[model samples]
Target: MKLLTVLFIGLIMMGPSDPTFKVGEVAPDIALPNMNGEIVKLSSLRGQMVFIDFWASWCKPCRKENPQIVADYMKYKDEEFENGTGFTVYSISLDKKKEAWQKAISKDSLIWTTNVSDLMGWKNEAALRYKIGSLPMSYLIDGDGVIVAVNPRGDKLEKALKKNRKSESWFKSLFGY
Candidate 1:
């Protein structure tokens, strides 16, 4: 009985643990310092479509993808969504230095969104909480806080946002907006 119990426990311990979260679930909240050093909470952006991106100043791929994300941001920021009213990005940088992060944001022209960081690099609180094992991790959540997409990039990012977009004439043709 003792040996059987030990084997069962061992198997249970070796089983895979859930990674942070997944699509369709409400995204876990993250509170960090914005560019202005103001504490911003992820939940505060409720009632809008939010893109939560985990990236870094030193990450080349993140830099490469910024322009596309910026373009998407501009395209959708003021637009209506099937699940939310407006769109915005909640960028979390995993940079150890403040200057490098700020510089990257400016150089990338990521000026239209809420860019934030704990300045802890890999040890960033949001990264750890989200179980971010790679650079440029991203999630798209709706107004209700439910995650709609994971790791969306480039046209895929824009596509995910657009797939659920409310048509320009949807309002005029429907009773509810």
Candidate 2:
């Protein structure tokens, strides 16, 4: 009986563990310093569907994706979503040089205000928390903090946002006043 109990307990300990992050799971809140050194928390944007993005100033693909991201933010930032009304982008940079990151932000015209990073390049605290494996990774989280989609880009990103939008009445859809 003692041996059986030890085996059972060991098996229980080795059982599958819950994932820290996945689609439909609540994204862990992240708080980091912005360009100006003020700390920003991801949970502060809970009432909006936020795109939690990870990128770096030196990443070419991330630079390429910035234009579309900016366009999407401008288009949907004020629009209503099924779980949240407005949209926002919470960008996390894996940049070792703060000046380079700030310069890239200006050059890319990424206008949303919640940008953050630990300035540790690949070892950024937020990137480790999210287990990020690649550049330009993003999570589309709903207003309630649930991740609804991952890495939706360009038209797909727009479509995903539209898909979650509250349905409009026929009158609103059919004619402009």
Which stretches of model 1 miss by more than 4 angstroms? Answer: 1-19, 168-177
lDDT of 1 at 88: 92
Q: Model 1, range 145-164, lDDT digits (tens) per residue?
A: 99888777778888888766
Best by lDDT: 1
Residue 99 shift from truth in candidate 2, angstroms: 0.6
Q: What tens-digit string does per-residue lDDT give for candidate 2 at 21-126?
A: 7788899989999999999999999989899888888877778889988999998899877789899999999999999999999999989999898899878888
Q: Model 2: runs farther than 4 Å from truth? A: 1-20, 168-177
Q: Enumerate clash totals for all models, in the order shown.
A: 0, 0
Stretch of 10 with least lDDT, candidate 2: 11-20
